[model samples]
Target: MATLLLRFLLKAALAFLAVSVLWVGVYRFVPPPVTFTMLGDVIGGHGITKDWMSLSEMDPDMARAAIAGEDSRFCAHHGFDFRAIGNAALRNAKGGRIRGGSTISQQTAKNAFLFQGGGYVRKAFEAYFTVLIEALWPKRRIMEVYLNIAETGIGTYGANAGSIRYFHHDASRLSASEAGRIAAVLPLPKKRAAISPTGFVRRHGNTLSRRVATVRDQGLDACLR
Candidate 1:
């Protein structure tokens, strides 16, 4: 009986891994209709507004703003930013706000495939999926998908939806300041709305706008270019 159970578990694990790899590969050239996060919203009884935007359909400034606001070292890292992770770890040890230091790759993995909240098991799966995406998808595709899938507001998902709902503009026409505002709310979308931002969010958007110029000037965004 023990042997039979072990065999079944192994088979299931293998099947899951195989399916995950194939799924990541397929999404390299294809857009996913929905993601696990969207389903989670439905299960939570929150109706979501999501509009898929290709990288080209999204303004280049928005892409750069996301890179600046989310992961400044996005072009240099593989799947994780060990330095930022170490900083977050030290800060968590001190125990104030308990901030997380997830990279864009890790977040893309979670937003696209996994659930919210952090646990050892969820993190393990997140790491595995992050590796899958980083290895299979280019920096551009990763950004495109991230922009399309990241939750931007309550009951809202994706840049296009957020842009239209908030600024009354399409994502393709988002100005730098508008893009910066959208990027600033990513960390706490449930709490912050880009349209009428709090003082902190407004300042954060300003900083991200400056970082956008820095990333462009430093060639930190060369990977996507």
Candidate 2:
């Protein structure tokens, strides 16, 4: 009986590995059709809103703004940023609310492959998928997938959709300020609005706008280039 159970578990694990590898490999060239988060939004009646735009079609400032705001060392790190993780751990230790140290690559992995917000089990899967994408996809493809799939507003997904929803334009030609505003809403898209931001959101958007130029100047997104 114990041997049978062990065999079953081993088969299950192997099946998972094979399927996940195939999924990641296919997404290397094909844009993902849907994700768990998008489905949840649809179920909640928020409806799906996404406009897929290739990285090449987007204005350079948009990607630069993301690099400046979300992960300054996006080009430097592999799948994880240990320094940021260490900093987040220190902050969480003080214990107001938990924070994550996820890099854009890790976020991409989660957004692409897994459902949102779970405990250690989900995190282990997230890490595994992150490694898989980093191995199978190029840096540019990873950025493209993240930009296209990220939740930008309540039910809205991708920079182009967010741009149209907020700025009445697509992401094809976003200015620094516009890109910054969209990027600012990324951390808490449901709570924030790029149309009329105030307080920290406004300030952070402005900061990100300025940093966009710096990111370009410093070549922080060199990997995408």
**CA RMSD per model (angstroms):** 1.4, 1.2
Best by lDDT: 2
Q: In model 2, where do residues sit more than 4 Å from their true spots?
A: 95-98
- Give, for candidate 2, the lowest lDDT window spanning 10 residues: 96-105
lDDT of 2 at 185: 90
With a 3 Å backbone cut-off (N, CA, C), the pairs that clash in candidate 1 are: none
Give me the candidate number with maximum TM-score: 2
Off by over 4 Å in 1: none
Cα lDDT listed for each candidate = 0.89, 0.93
Per-residue lDDT over 83-168 for candidate 2, one digit per residue giving the tens place of the 0 to 100 score: 99999999999998687788899999999999998989999999999999999999999999999999999999999999999989
TM agreement with the true structure for every prediction: 0.95, 0.97
- Residue 160 of model 1, lDDT score: 87
